[model samples]
Target: MEKGQRMKIVTRTRAGTITGLMVVVLVLAGLALPAVAPRSLIQDLFFILTMLSLAQVWNLLAGYGGLVSVGQQAFVGIGAYAMFAMVILFGWDPVPAVLVGGVAAVILAVPTAFFAFRLQGAYFAIGTWVIAEVTRLLVAQWKALGGGTGTSLPREATSDIMGVELIRTLFDVREAAARDILAYWLALILTVCIIGGIYWLLKNRLGLALAAVRDNTEAARSVGIDTTRLKWAVFLIAAFATGLIGALIYVQTARISPDAAFSLTDWTAYVIFIVVIGGIGTLEGPIIGVIVFFVLQSALSDYGAWYLLTLGLLAIAVMLFAPKGLWGLIAARTGLRLFPVQRRLVGHDINGGK
Candidate 1:
């Protein structure tokens, strides 16, 4: 040991640096995909990117904030409906309406948190589900928005959305295909922002506080952490992001129905599956999980109920054999962390000697 030395906290690792470069390359490739890829493939990517965004938000809420909410469909539905309302009612363009959707979701989250935050553990989960159901029912009563049956976005709105013309001009594709490309690009951007933002957060002091709160609420509180505020912030942030994703999803589909918009199976359950199977607490887990999920869906979806059964069985097997998830298991065994969040202390002599 040296008498006079300096210590620095480092969170970067060799693997993470390489992974970051790889991610940049992949993103660039994704941006170029519409130029060469088929329309169906672009649509498939939109699905994957949206689902990944949802899974990441859910992971942030449940994995880091210690808030296990099963009713995230509420935000998705609200966000979609809000965007629909903007287009159908106020005649706003769908592109800007997507942002409104996020804002609307945040508005819903305020009251939702006020109620759901009072409950703990499973009760909190149930509370969220109940709220989502209630919201769905209320939205169904909005006859202006098609009541229970739902309505489709106006053709004019979809045909003339911002960026669609540019894409159509560049690719010489139809309006429908151009719209899909625009949506796909937005999804790609959203996914990257959410992942990058979460990683940055995980490397900061607030991330440490979040981990402490997730691990031991009482202990965190004992150490002067404001657990309530932290949870609130995480909840609202998740709601806004989920809402934005939701809105973007419907914009691409150009259709909105209460049942589909607020489907627990699509928005929440599938997301939970992705996070659980991939690794809930790690950023890399959702990336791995979504890929696995999409592969499984593509392969077994033709089997109807068997597809769900297979997913159920796989999830159960993973839970029993690898509770930490596939990524967690891999990281534990190989000591490989592509998204290193743990801070390490490095010491050097004040005179610059190592």
Candidate 2:
């Protein structure tokens, strides 16, 4: 080592500047999409944003928190139901109602965590599912929202949405197009918040503790990490975020049913598939996974059962060949990370892991 040389210990990625510029360009492009893109495309973007948010939330819980919950649908359904109830019974604005749903999910998470934290590993996963079923049964008893059947948001409620009229005027589109744009905008904001929040969390000290716990809970606890509190906090946070996404989804659809809202396949299975297919532990994994899943759905969904079968087969294939996921494989080969989180000491010996 030369005495005149200095070590540059850093957390910033080599690609950080380029990645930040790319993100800004993408966001600007997305916001202007309605001007050139059709309404249907806007609706599809909304779907992608909402589902992407849900997947990211799920990934944070299972991938980093080591709480592999199989019943995130519980939070989704609870949020959707709460949003509907607020609109129907209390006459709240649909937009604000979505926040109410998140709060409801947070409240639900209290008891959910109390029971779920009692179990470990696979048992915890199953326990969460059971609690979801119980929640569904209880929600099914609410007659105001059509009991077990379900109901659509009244035309008045949908038509009078906060920004729909303004969007219609600004874009010179029809009511429906305007509505889709509004939903798309909300989805965009929410997705950014979810991803950004998770990224920030992973960069902080708690993220280190979370990683330690994920590797070995006992070892983490031996080192004085409050694994229990961390798990509970993560479970509750995921529930709130997932719930908010669910409520936003139904708010745009203007429809809700217990079965559809609480469906394991739509809310939980698909999300798990997205995260697993992309990369479980990495933040960028969900983004890549959701894009791939959306592509498959768009291309093959018309084949009905074939689409489902293909997804299953592809998931199995990825597990067998590229256990870390598609993004993981590429990163391993190229040392690329769209959302880099791992910290490495690489400058020089004098860096001293500083």
- Candidate that would win on lDDT: 1
The all-Cα superposition gives candidate 1 an RMSD in Å to the true structure of 2.1
Determine which window of 10 residues in candidate 1 has minimal summed lDDT: 345-354
The clash number for model 2 is 0
List residue ranges in candidate 1 displaced over 4 A. Answer: 1-5, 348-354
Q: List model 2 lDDT by residue over 1-354, tens digit each.
A: 556455653557867657878988988899888988998889889999998999999999999998999999999999999999999998888999999999999999999999899898999999999999999999999999988999988888888889888888888999878888988988898998899898888878778889888888899899999988898878888999998999999988888899999999999998988998999899889889999999999999889989889988989998898888988988888988777777765555645533
Error of 1 at 235 (Å): 0.2
- Per-model clash counts, in order, read 0, 0
TM-score for every candidate vs. truth?
Answer: 0.97, 0.95
Tens digits of per-residue lDDT for model 1, 120-159:
8999999999999999999999999999999999888887
